[model samples]
Target chain A: MEPSDLAGMALIAVAGPEDALAFVSSGASSSAALEQEMNAVLNDSGVPRWPGLAAALLRWRPRLTDLAPERDLRVVERLGGQLLVPEDPEWPVALSELELNEPIALWVRGRALVIPEQKRCIALVGSRDSTSYGANVAMEMAATLVQRGFTIVSGGAYGIDAQAHRGAIGAATGRQFLPTLAIMAGGVDRFYPTGNEDLLRAVAENGAIVAEVPPGANPTRYRFLQRNRLIAALCEVTVVVEARWRSGALSTAHHADGLSRTVAAVPGSVYSANSAGCHRLLREGSAVCVTDAADVAELAGAPGTQLTPEQLGAPAVHDGLGVEDLMLLDALPLRSVTSVDKLTIVAGIGATAVLAGLGRLELLGLAERANSGWKRRC
Target chain B: MEPSDLAGMALIAVAGPEDALAFVSSGASSSAALEQEMNAVLNDSGVPRWPGLAAALLRWRPRLTDLAPERDLRVVERLGGQLLVPEDPEWPVALSELELNEPIALWVRGRALVIPEQKRCIALVGSRDSTSYGANVAMEMAATLVQRGFTIVSGGAYGIDAQAHRGAIGAATGRQFLPTLAIMAGGVDRFYPTGNEDLLRAVAENGAIVAEVPPGANPTRYRFLQRNRLIAALCEVTVVVEARWRSGALSTAHHADGLSRTVAAVPGSVYSANSAGCHRLLREGSAVCVTDAADVAELAGAPGTQLTPEQLGAPAVHDGLGVEDLMLLDALPLRSVTSVDKLTIVAGIGATAVLAGLGRLELLGLAERANSGWKRRC
Candidate 1:
C-alpha cells in the first residue's frame, strides 16, 4: 500500500470501519478510479461488464465510506469494535436501501444485532421543548410498546425523547437487557448534553447506543441529522408527540415516511402551539393520529402483538340489566337521548314504567343524564 | 265540516305535513273522524308527526264546550303568545325536517327569517359540563363564524351551549342585531336555565329565539331531546367540541348526521375524560374532525357555491416560494429536530447559501427556529 493508503488504513483502524466510509465519501476525489487502470481500456473497448462495475463503484462512493471498509481484517482486530461491511451476512441490507443517507459502514459495539429480529422496533421522537401533555403521551406509548415485547428506539435527548427512553426502561426495568435503544448524535463513548448522562449510561448498559460517527468524534449538527436516518431505517414505526413547526423530531418522521415506516403522532389541544407540528403531520397525512399505547400498538402491530390473558383488560358491557331496563335503554337509543316522558311515548308504556326502568339502569351505570334527558352509556 | 271532522283535523294537524302525507297514504283515520276515534287513532299511530290542529283544537275545547275551528287561532295565541304555524311562510321549514321530533307549531319572536339563505349557519353543541378547552373552541368558532356572516345556532343552555351564544354576541357585540340564533326547549317566555335570560333575550332581539312548546309550558327532558333534532336540522353544520362518551352533544351530532348536515367535532387531549364523546364521534365517523372555524367553513363551503369575491376571504395559498419550498418543507416536517447544516447537505447547497435563504425566508415569517433547526411555518 502507498503511504497515504497506509495512513488512511490506520485512520480507519482508529476511526473504525464506519468512519472510513464517511471519509472516502467526503473526499469525492479519485473519480472512483479503480486501484488499477485495467478497466480503462476495457471501457474504451465498450465492455459492458467493466462499465457496470465501474458505475456501481463510483455510484457507491457516497454510501461506501459511511461504513469506511478496510481491505484487511488484521487492522480491525486492534479496535475493540468490529467492522460490519456490506459483504457480512448479518449486515443489514435493509439499511443500504436507505439510498443517499444510507450508512456505508456500521461501527457497532456489544452484541452485533440483526435488524429483522428487531422487526417490532419503533422510533419515538418529538420536541426538545415538550409539554406535560406531550411527555405523558410519549411515555405512555413507550411503556405499552415495550410491554408488548417491542423494542423501543429513540434519540437520547431531553423532553419527549428522554421520556420515551425512560418509559421503555420502565416497561422493561427488571429485565436482563433493556428492550430500549437510544441513538446519539455524537460518538457512542462520549455522551452529549451531560444532563442525560445517567439515562444514556443505563441505555448503553442495558440496550445498545448505536452511532455512525467514530469513537471520540464530537457530534456536529450535520452528524445528528445523518444519524436520524438510521433510526427511521431501523424501526417499523416512528411516533411523534409534540413539536413546533421546526422541530427535528419531524425529520425523524420524514425519514420514517421515506422508509415506509408507520408514523404516528399524539394529538394535542388546538390551542396549544406545541402541538402544531403534530397537527400538521396529521393534516398532511404524514402521520396517523395516535391517542394511547394501545393505539400506537394497534397501528404498528409490531412483534409484540400478543397480550397475556391477564392483560387482556376487557371493557364492561352493560348486559346485566333486567329485561325492563334493557327495554328502556333500547328505547332510549331509538333516539340518542330521550326525556322520561318521551321514553314513555316511544316505549308505548306509562310514565310510571318508563321512570322506573330509567331509575334502575341509572343505578347500573348503563345510562347517563344528557342535558335534561337520558342517553345510553358505554 | 262535521263536528266529527274537527277531531280528525286536530289529529292530522298534530301529525304534521310529513306524517299527514303518511297518514293519507296509509289510509288512516281522516281529519273528520270523531273525537273518540281520533284519540284512538292518534295513540295507535307509530309515526311521531304532530297533529297541529289537534293541539289548537284541544286548547279551544274549554271555551267552546264544542269543537270549533274559528276558535283555534285564539287558543293558539292564548297558549303560547303568537303561534308561527307551518302554514305561515315566515315559519322556518328547517323544523319540519326533523321527522319525528318535528314540532306541530313553533312560537317565534324577533325578526322573521328563512333558512337555506345566502348565509351559512352552524350549530355548536356539547356538554353542559364543558372543559375550558371546549369552551375556548366554542368561543373561537362562534366568533369567527359570526364574523364571516355565518349565523351561529346553539341551544340556550349552560357550558358549551352558553358559550356559543356568548361568542356570537361578542363577535358583533354592539351591532344592530347579532348574527346568532337560539333554539329553546320550552316556551319562549320561560328561558330554561334562567341564567341565560339576558342572552336569550338578546338573541331574540338581535337574531332569533324559537320554542316548540306552548307559551306557558315548561321544558321537560323529552322536550330538550326533541329540541336537539331541530337545532341540527336548522344549521348547515353541527360541531361537538367536548362531550362525555354518552352526551347530549353526541346526540346532536347524530341528529345532524341523520339530517345529512356536515357534522364536525374539535378533538381534545385523550387524557381528558371530558373529551371522550368527541373522540368517540371521530372514531365512529359520526363527525368530521375540525380544529377551527376556517376548517369548518371550508369543508361546509360558505353555504353556496357562488361566493362573491369579498366573501371568499383569503385564498389558501400564501406568498412566493412555490413548489420547491413546499416540497422541501413537506419533506423535512417538524417533529424531530433537523439541523440547518443537514438540510443544506440534503438539498445539495453550500451551508452558507442555504442559511442565507432560510434567514430571508424567516424574515418573511414563513420559517421558525425549533431547537436551532429551521422549518417552514404555517
Candidate 2:
C-alpha cells in the first residue's frame, strides 16, 4: 500500500481500534472519504452521516492532521516488522469471533504470524506476582504444549507470562511451527516492561510480538485491558496458570469464555493468595480444572481426537481381588494364626469358600501358612 | 425389650447386619421363628422362602446356635455403650437413603446418636497419609462447621480424619451440639488404629463413635470400605479434604454422590499427590470446589439460608472507576508531565472530560499537578 493509504487508516486508528471499525462501517472507503462525508454533514449538505459518525469525526479530525503514519510505518520497517491488516492471510481467522470489536490492523514484529487452518493456538496467562510453583507449572505446561504441536500466546509481562515465553522459545529446538507469540499492549517497536526485554526479544526471533496501536504508542491501562481481548480472540483456548483474587488474567479468561472458547484454570494451594483467582474460576464453573499439558490439549484439540481417559495411579497389590478373596483376606490375622474354620465364620463365607480363598491369597503372596493355620504375609 | 428378644436379635446379627434386616423382612419375629421357617422350607412345607432367604438362613444357622446377644449387651452396658436399632428416634434418618443396604443396627459409644430432624451433618474424609496443608484445612473446616451447629462425621482413622475430630472436639466448648462423630469400621468398643485411641475417646465423649458390627468385631478391610458407605449415608454432604489418585475417601465421595448427596472437594497444589483425587473429582464434575469453612457450611446448610457470596479480597485503587476516568488515568504519565490538550488526544476523550477526570483522579490521589501539567501520583 502507498503511504497515503497507510496514513488514512492510521488517522482513523489513532482515535482507537474501535474507531477504525466504525469508520469502515460508515460506507466510507478511507479516512479521506469519511472526511468528505463529515465536511458535508458539518455544512448541512450531503447524505446523512452514519449514527455516531459526527462525534467520531470530531475525535479523529484532531488526530488526522497531527499524526504521520508514513514515519510510523518506516519506523516499524526499519525494525524488521510489518503492518498487518485484517485482509492479510496471516491474520488469525479466530479473531473474527470478536465481530464488530475486532482490531482494525495488527502491527507485528519478527516472523510472520502463522496460525494454521487447524488453529492450534493457546493462550497461557496469569498474575505478574506468581509463586515459584505457579511459574514452574506455567513453564512446564507451555513447553509440553509446544512439544505437542501447539503455539503459545501470552502477554509480554512478568512472572508466568515471561516463563511461558521462555519455555516456548527454549523448547522450539528443531521444531517446525512458530514457538510463541507475545501480544503487547505497547508499540511493537518497544517491549514495555524493561525487565523482560531479553525474553520478549527472543520471543520475536522465534515467532512475533504484536500490538494493535502504531509505533511509539504507550501501554496505557485501558490499552492493556483492550489488549486482553486480542489474546482471547486469537486463541482457541485460554488457560490461566495462577492469579490473585483480582487480576487482569481473569478478565482475559472471561473474554475467552465470552467468545465461546475453552477456558481452563490450574488449581494451586488453597492457602496461596496467588491461587485464589484460579479457585474462584473453578467455583464459578467458568473454567475446567487443568493439571498438566494433556488436560489442556484435550480441551483445545479437535473433538474426540485427544479424549483419552486420564491414567490412574500405579495399581495396588489388592486392586483386582474378587469378593470372597477380599473378605477372606480381611479376616486373616496379621500377626497371629487363626484356624480355617474360624476364618470361615469371621469372613462370613463357608468352609470350602474360605479354604479356596486362602489358596488364592497364598498364591498371590498376600497370605501364608503359619504354624497350624493362615496369617497375612508381610 | 426382654432378654429372650435381645438373644434372638443378637443371634441373627451374628451373621451380619444384613441378616437381621432379612430376618425381619421374612415376617419372622425372632431367630427362633426364622429357624422354624427354615425347617418348613427344608421339609417342602408352608409358603416358599423369600427369594434368597433359604440361602441366607444357612449362613446364619451356624452363628445363631453359637452366639449370645445377652452377653454382648452386658459387655456394651459395662462399657457405658448401647445397641441402637433403626426403630429408635436417635438413628440417623439419612441412613435410610441406603434403602435395602441400610445397617440394621448401630453399636454406639458416646453421647446418644442424635441427628436432629434438620439433619445437620457433613462427612469429611481423606487419606491417612495427609500433608500438613490438607490436615490444617481439614481441622479449620471442622472447627468452623461445628461452630456453625453442624455435626462432622469422618472415618475413625489417622491423618485428615484425626485432625477433623480434634478440630471439632476443641471447638465444641460451651456448645450444645455433638462436636463430631467417628464412624468406625471396627466395633465402637475398640478404636482400631491405636494411634488415634485418645482422639477417638475424646470424640466419643463429645459426639459418638459408632459401628455397624457388634463388639469385638475386627475392622477388616471389607469393613473399612463398608464403613465408608455409612459415612456417606449418615451425612447430607461429603467433603474429601485431600486424597491420593485412588483413595478410600474418594470412594466415600462417590458413595455420597451415588446417594444423591452433595459432594465437595478441597483444591490444592496440582503437583501434590494428596490432591490428585480432589482434582479428579473436580474434573469429573463429581464435586464442588470448597476452600474455606463458609463454603462447606453453604454446601451443608438449608437451601437459601447460608447462600452468601464469597467475600472478595481487599479493594484495589482502580476499582469502580468509570470508563472515561480509567482512560484518562491511563493517559497520565508516571514520571513525566503532559498538557490537557495532549491528554485529550491520548485518552480519546474531550478536553472537558479530561479536565474533570483529572480532578477526580487528583481527589483520589492517583494523579496530581506536575510543574506545568499533569502526571500520575505515586
Best by TM-score: 2
lDDT of 1: 0.65
User: Which residues of candidate 2, in runs, are more than 4 Å off?
Assistant: A1-51, A116-119, A302-311, A334-340, A355-378, B1-51, B116-119, B302-311, B334-337, B359-378
Tell me how candidate 2 scores on lDDT.
0.79
* lDDT (CA) per prediction: 0.65, 0.79
Q: How far is candidate 1 from the true structure (C-alpha RMSD, Å)?
A: 11.4
lDDT, residue A131, model 1: 90
lDDT of 1 by residue, B77-196 (tens): 443346666688766666666543455677665544434342367888889998898899999899988887788888898999889988887887655444777888776766668887
lDDT (tens digit, per residue) of candidate 1 on A138-196: 88888887877777888899998899988888787665544788777666666677998
Q: Compare the candidates by DockQ and give the number of the best one.
A: 2
> Where's the lowest-lDDT run of ten residues in candidate 1 chain A?
A1-10
Q: List candidate 1 segments past 4 Å from native.
A: A1-105, A110-119, A185-187, A212-223, A258-260, A284-286, A302-378, B1-106, B111-119, B174-178, B212-218, B283-289, B302-378
lDDT by residue (B346-369, candidate 2, tens digit) is: 877656678889999999999999
Interface-residue RMSD per candidate? 11.8, 5.2
**Clash pairs, model 2 backbone:** none
